[model samples]
Target chain A: MHIYVTDHNGKEHELEALEGWRVMEVIRDWGLPIKAECGGACACATCHVFVDPDWQDKLHAASDEEEDMLDMVPDVEDNSRLSCQILMSEELDGLKVSLAPSAKPDAEVA
Target chain B: MSEQEIVTDVVIIGAGPVGLFAVFELGLLDIKCHLIDILDKPGGQCAELYPEKPIYDIPAFPEISGQELTDNLLKQAEPFGPTYHYNRMVNELEKQDKGDYLVKTDAGETFRCKVVVIAAGGGSFQPKRPPVPNIEDYENTSVFYAVRKMDDFRDHDIVIVGGGDSALDWTLNLAPLAKSLTLVHRRDSFRAHTDSVNKMRALVEEGKINFELGQIASLEGENGQISAVNIKNADGEKSLPATRLMPFFGLTMKLGPVANWGLNLHENLIEVDTEKFATSEEGIFAIGDINYYPGKLKLILSGFHEAALMAQAAKKIIHPDEKVVFQYTTSSTKLQKKLGVK
Candidate 1:
């Protein structure tokens, strides 16, 4: 399946991601700009990305923990989702996401 | 007597998997290093977040737990003899007149290094502060999440909170140092080591330290110096004299002091070039998740590769007179000898 990742700079990268692998894992395997710092533990908000609004309903809802972490992320939009929780499947092929502007500690983001 | 400033060829911040491997890479070139991390142990996120969690894709290791990987990295870096300074955060960085970097930590130690490797995975980890109004105002002076200097509390009235290892450990440690010491916890039970708990009970019985069964409700002090704290018990509210408050709540990750270092930041991560993994600042390289670049992959294997290239660049900065010769560990006898392989 081709998983499309729109980097922070708006460059689209078409990744041949395998099934059952997470969006974060596929993005990481392709060496995308996503940090995935906690390595899909959903602990760090580095993997937070904006799901294309058109495909937002196509993917499963974000987990409670992922939502909590997304809330911690700066510049969170209604389409925000943690890429780690987004598992890749054949049906979800062509899933597009734009990397969110990475968030720092709340005090330092300014 | 003036304290001798510790000097090294390179100072790598954050003793995670990448920093440990950097020690090995730099050690091959005879470059000495000293690594610093805020955590008490090495292996930043691996050992801290998911020690028992199994990690896949760690090249050559089909299946290995995070702790196992960290232990192996420690063993791998042992021959290099890189000094490890744990439980400290780098608070300041300054370019010295001699072109070396003058690095200072919260623990009051300084280092002069020709090259700086920032492997600080997700920046410094700090203890989660309890919810108290204006609690941030008392940090560093009267309230300390970490004990940087043991002597800082000498002859002072100290009150330790929480039921964890840190609280009990500090209670026993500071009892002899403080003019008066008191430990307060909501429950009678403790979550510390059995021996430390027994020692603390002994001290309580000996009248050396007071053990109050309650939670701190409010803090009272002025000018960042805490004088007293109100404790809420089952019976009533009581106040204790406390010149210093040591709360040992568990740690949480934050960008910490690294944000103020004046490095180019993509969000909280330092921007780096993939060629040398060097940050925007000259002679300062950032690898691992703490670094950001185009198509940056935050993985241990990626960090290892970055450490390799970073060491080569660092060697040039550390010893400009010597030429950097790239060699493979498989065929190079010099590399094998450095690895102590028979």
Candidate 2:
């Protein structure tokens, strides 16, 4: 499926994601700045981002841990999801996600 | 209230890897520091959580656990004359008439120093709590953001919430220790690495771990302890019996009291000059994960580079003497000798 990823500076890139690939790997494999520090373990919230409002409903709902991590993200809104928590699917063919300017440092937010 | 004030050349506000690295850098410059932190021990989050976990990206070292790396960093900083105060949180920082800064801690101790470096990493980072009512009360009791002191939950049925690597890794670690383990993910697929996810899947296939693909709708507790977790899976909602809940869901980004420090905060990161790592305010600087610069790589090696450069700039600002030559440490001096650079 084609997914649109946006960087912190609003730069957009259209990339194809395998049917079940996590959004974080899609962005990281493309050499995006999303740290995914915990290596997409969902342990670190460094891969946090905001899903486009239009495709919010199309994506899977964030789990409790993802929700908790989003709370630590700066500029968090109703649409924030840790990119690692998002899995590519046919339903989210044209998903758009924006990287947050900063992931909450491990020390400050925990 | 009586406040004790002490003066030092530098005041580092963390005891983590980067903060300790600053002490080592300052030692090379022959500067003294007054280091403060809220934790009772050093290593910040590393000491608190995942001390035994292996880290592989520390430049020269192929792999080392968090504890070993912290020990090495501390040893490197010991000679630089850093006075460490534990269990003390910096409450505020005020500029003095003499151009220095007064750092006041929550414990009523005040430090007067010419420069301040914020090196707090994930320890100061707090986890986001579910928005369900009464969630805050369970913090540090039965609910926690991380698995601090794993033995605390030995033989207890623990429910870990998250689909990422942390959730999977911790589940694998705690699975053998806990009496029973439950992993709840928002989706059937996980985002963790292949090996860790495969291990978890194996455990699930063997019926050794209970895997729930869903969300935690609410948490019910009693006497300030979490008793059960309300989970809503794809099948339906169910109340899982939980003695201790470890939520690896992830961190939330909040600057806390530091937000009011008047530093230029962009998207929760402190804005600092790239070359000097200096914040908008004089005598104030940020490094490591808290500060971001253009073209900067956020690696431990990069943090060390920033610490050295920022320490040099700070030394020049604190003691601007044309005749004062920068002396290299034993390790750095050896490298310099080999490289033949003056």
Candidate 3:
């Protein structure tokens, strides 16, 4: 399975994802410029991403913990979700997400 | 200004789990210690990041929360009476001519120690800088991450951005002082305490402070002073006049100052041997998630084991002529006496 991830530079990369793996893990594994500082513990909001409008309804809703973590993010939107909370599944084979500027590594942030 | 100098047998740079555990192991060998941490409290990430999260891997306990584990570790190390210096970062480390090390902190304190143990897990926790363009330009002037003085905001147009406790608390504290105070957040709901949220709402209703639902879009400034801040919300882009701006996003770990300590680093982590867990410098050890080895696992238990081994080496360095004897806490009367169990 795979997912489409657009980085902060507006470049899209097709990443090979595994079933039951976190979308953030897949993106980080593919060498995408994501901070993902907490390593998917939902302790931080560094893995924030904007889900494509079409894929928004396909994924599960964000939990209260995830929402609380999102409160720390400076640039959040209506569709902003912590990618670490989203598990890649067969239904999300082509899950589309665009990395928020806040998700990039601190050094890479312009 | 004259700095306070402390003398100790060993100086551990980090009060995290591993550093706390090192106190027990070093104390057993008759070594005294002093710990330094950047956080106001100890436990490092376990205390700050996920204090309530249950960790499943800790031995003996099937599930233990981070804060609980930290409290237990502190209890375990209490008999040793290790001193902790919190809210300070070790800015410089140098080997003295007398072979001991001199450690200097940003808080204007110094330590002379026989050995240095770095249990710094993922480095120091620092306030996250918002990704606003050229935000660095206004730092310590028009833009501040932390409020050091309430008088700085007095009579100034202040714009605070965040929904957490720092933002709300500062909003309430600085509302009376500012010419105009605006609380901006990305969402209507706040993650701060209910009391603080209620108080902030009361201020908004009283027309003392304005609450806006939006994210900071940009900053308008000149010569390191911001004149206005642009925020984007559901309605449209809005600009608020501001002399001071504070954005409290949260804390993130960065390998600060430690990178300049002349220690060999592998991928931003200190390189250490698995045997002694010692760094490139003699009498200096690195453990926990901050140290890298061939089969290193960044687990609390792994850090515990490294602390035990590192303690033995540190003891040897501190007291070379003393004959080292291996004794288990369960069987040895000397060890039990040291643990205050006798």
Candidate 4:
């Protein structure tokens, strides 16, 4: 499987992913500029992303725990979701998500 | 607030699980320690980020929550009588002329120690700033992350954002003082305590405050003075007259001031040797998730082993003339006595 992730600067990168693995792991394994601080535990909102509006319906709704974590994201949008909660599958191979500004590494903020 | 300097054998930089364990290891060697943490309590990320979350790989315990592990570690290190200084961050670290190291914090405290342990896990947790465009311009004037004094918000149209305890508690607290108060959140529901949420709902029922379901879109003001805060929601766009704005968006970790201490770092993690977990500088050590070595596993057990080895090395530096002895806590009566078992 593969996932399409857009960086904060709008640069798109196609990453090879494995089934059942988190979408966050795919983006981070490929050396993207993500701050997944809690390592996909949904403990932190550093992995926040904006799922493409077209692909929003294909994914399941955010769990209550995930929603609580999203409350930490300051710049969340209507399509916002934590990539860690999104699992890659054969049904949704090319899931497109744009990295939220809050998800970027703190060192790259400037 | 300059006070007398605190002299100790070792100064641990963090009060996390690993830092707390270091106190036990150092104590068995008859070395006293003083721990400093930025948080108001111990446990570091364990307490702050996931206090109730279960951890699976903590050696003996099959599944222990973050808070439980922290509590146990504190109990184990209690016999050492280590001092804990919370709510202060180490801002400056320099070697003194007398061979001891001088450590300074943002709270204006000074300490002299022979060994410095950099056990800070993932640096320090700081408030996450919202990505509102040009929000920086209004910081400290029209926008505030924390309320230092309630009088500063008196007579102003205050807009508090978020659904957490900080937002709801402040809304209920400052509502009586403000001319107009508005609570904005992305959703109508809140994650605060039931009592606080109920009080906030009562305030809304009394028409004493305004509740809006939306996120902050932008700020309106000039010269660091905000006039209004624009928000977007299901109904459409709306602007609230906000003389003061407070956003409680939780916290994120960043490699703070530790970067300026002139130590070798790899990807923001302190580089240390595997044998002693010592950093580039002598009398300084790095452990836990904050240190990096070849094939480092970053497990809690690995940090425990590092703490044991670092204690031995630290004991040598503090008392160079004394010959060190290796003893296990299980059979050695001397070690048992230090642990308060004998």
Candidate 5:
């Protein structure tokens, strides 16, 4: 399957994502600056991305952990989702998302 | 003034199992190594995640705890005398015109190395700071997350906040060095080791340290230097005279600036060839869980294998004329000499 990612520098990359990989895997494989610090654990929000409005309904529903992690991320919107939770599949082909701001240290709580 | 820039033959990016082994491997070939890790100490995920958990997979040991394994690795690499830069993250890696790389840290430290090894297991672990306004401004000054040098806090009025091991550990360590020490927490309970807690209580009884039950309300200082902290307790907000503040809340994992170094990544991991464990970038290699290969197992023993191969390849980069030879540590006099066992 194919997925499009717009990196932090506004450079777009079209990647061939394997069937079982997550959206984060595709972007990270392209070396596009997505931290994915926790490695798809849904614990860190470094992989937060804004799903293209057109493909919003195509992704699997965000789990409670993903929702909470996304909530912790700065500049989150209705389209905000952790790319790690969005697994790649045949139905989710051609997914497009723009990288969110780097999970800043300020976003962390005491 | 900036710290003196370091120059070495190899700069291992993580001081985990693979990185430590890389030091030993490279040292056998007469190459010096320097290691940088975001964590305050070595062991990476093993020490951070399950230090006490027993694992039966390591080669000779029938069973060993995570911390025990890390201790053994560090001991094994001690002969190499690898320089370890802890509590710092490598933020930049740029190739020099001479072909060596200049590695810069977020702390403004730099290293020039002929080979870079990424043994970063599962990414770098970052500290989770308390939510305070403009906290970054005070970082590395009066406010420190990790103590690199004990003498830096000698004779200073220090206030440590947290109920965990880091807070309790530093409290025990810095109590005598600090002129006036205070340990603050929301309640009297602590998640630290009982021995540390009892020792802390003893210090408080001996009038060496002040134990306060409260939470930090605000910080007071000027020009990134802290003088006092307003803590909220049952009596409401009260100002405590303090010169240095240490908040040991805990750590959070973040890959941090590694992705920006232009290395080829495969799912948040560096891609390396199996033969040399070399990344797409020349003179750079990745091992441990941070590197992906055709049949990588992400095991500590597997990383040890990668380290041996990586060191051989790194020798070519560090000294092209050096002839690489395979020698068994049990019988080879040269290998035993490097290990300092002969």
Candidate 6:
């Protein structure tokens, strides 16, 4: 399947993804910076991305825990999802996602 | 040869910031701990990745380097009676019939503890490299996924690959220290913060750093030293001389040896109880970066909170007869009072 990932820089890369792989895995395997701190178990929201408006219907509804995690994420929106929660499939062939800004603040150590 | 295992009050899987917090939490309850990690030193991944980089989000301290945080965490954990086994990886965890757990490491050592906490952060996700030829030969000698020490690159020519914050941030930080610094990215734009990108651009404009927008065609090095890096930029193929190649290309998380434990894992992360940080297994608990709990925040501060709560829950489970009274230390008590959590 084809997955289009828009990075934090607003650049998009169209890459081939395998069905059954989590969105976070596809992004990470393709060498994109999604963090996925909890590795897509719906734990940490670092892998959060916005799904394309058109393909949003293909994804499973976000769990309550995912909702809570999203609340803590900065710049959260109606389309926000922890990429680890979205599994790629034939139905999601044209999935489009944009990398969210990392919540980690600026460097303090000098 | 069934040798009796030496059991402890608790066993912590990693010695990073959260693991140290566990030590402190257990210490407050008069519980002894055995902490193990693969790094020769404490602080787990924080000490391994960006040890020189300053961290701003840690509570109280406005900013501290990874090394400093590790040092402070070690001091805090040590005072609480925790024994650390550095340079060891926990290869397996087996539950005993009596409800305790036995942890065996790759070093052939074993420890029995009532609770196990996995704080192995992004350390397990080794770096991912593009399909570039000749990159495998310099895995350790020159091409590196992590920066162990900053002084090691002093006065040397270095080439960094990646367009993200890690790559850009490191370039900006190391530009002044290295004799020559060249940054190559697959795309023109960067994923780093605007301020960082602006600073790097200023440096590049002043001829302090070289910014090459392109992909690495190949890597050339020999005898434990990287001599040059060849790249395919917008202008065509070009070769740049370098002493070391640091690829912040990004990390790929692996569950490592713990993947065999049969815990409910979502991809590479272990699922945990939202309230208690307990895993699907009764006595196994996860915290820090490797754990997944719905609605949980993933920051050092959030990890600290999770460690505190998990420690309390684990304590209650291990000592059912005892009443878990949280006696806040003076500092903690004062902070609690200020937050009005009375």
Full-model lDDT for every candidate: 0.82, 0.75, 0.90, 0.91, 0.82, 0.75
Tell me which of candidates 1 and 4 scores higher on TM-score: 4
Tens-place lDDT digits, model 6, residues A1-110: 88998976789999899989998889888887666654454544567788889878778898766674553343455678888788888988988988876422110000
lDDT of 3 by residue, B125-194 (tens): 8888777789989999889888878898899999999988999999999999899999999888988999
Per TM-score, the best of the predicted structures is 4
| Candidate topping DockQ | 4
Docking category of candidate 2: incorrect
- Candidate 1 shows a clash count of 0
Q: Report the C-alpha lDDT of model 5 over B83-133, residue by residue, as the tens digit.
A: 999988898999988788999998888898899998888667866666555
DockQ of each: 0.07, 0.18, 0.46, 0.52, 0.12, 0.06
What's the lDDT for candidate 5? 0.82
Between candidates 1 and 6, the one scoring higher on lDDT is 1
Computed on C-alpha atoms, the DockQ of candidate 1 is: 0.07
Better of 2 and 4 by lDDT: 4
Top-scoring candidate (lDDT): 4
lDDT of 1 by residue, B168-276 (tens): 8899988998999999876676657789999999999999999998777789999988889888877889999999998764455678788888899997889999899
B-chain TM-score, every candidate? 0.77, 0.64, 0.97, 0.96, 0.73, 0.62
Q: How much is A52 displaced in model 3, in angstroms? A: 3.1
Summed over model 4, clashes come to: 0
Better of 2 and 5 by DockQ: 2
Kindly list the per-residue Cα lDDT of model 2 for residues B1-342, writing each as its tens digit: 124678889999888788999998776676788889777778765565447667788988999877898999987777555799997778799988867888999898888888988876532544555545576677788877667798988898899887667788899999998888899876566767779989998998998889987677788878878889888755789999988886664543345667778889765678888787899988788888778778756566777888888887888768877445655545577434433447
Range of the 10 consecutive residues with the lowest summed lDDT in candidate 6 chain B: B333-342
Instruction: Compute the lDDT of residue B243 as modeled in candidate 6.
Output: 87
The 10-residue segment of model 3 chain A with minimum total lDDT is: A101-110
Clashing pairs for model 5 are: none
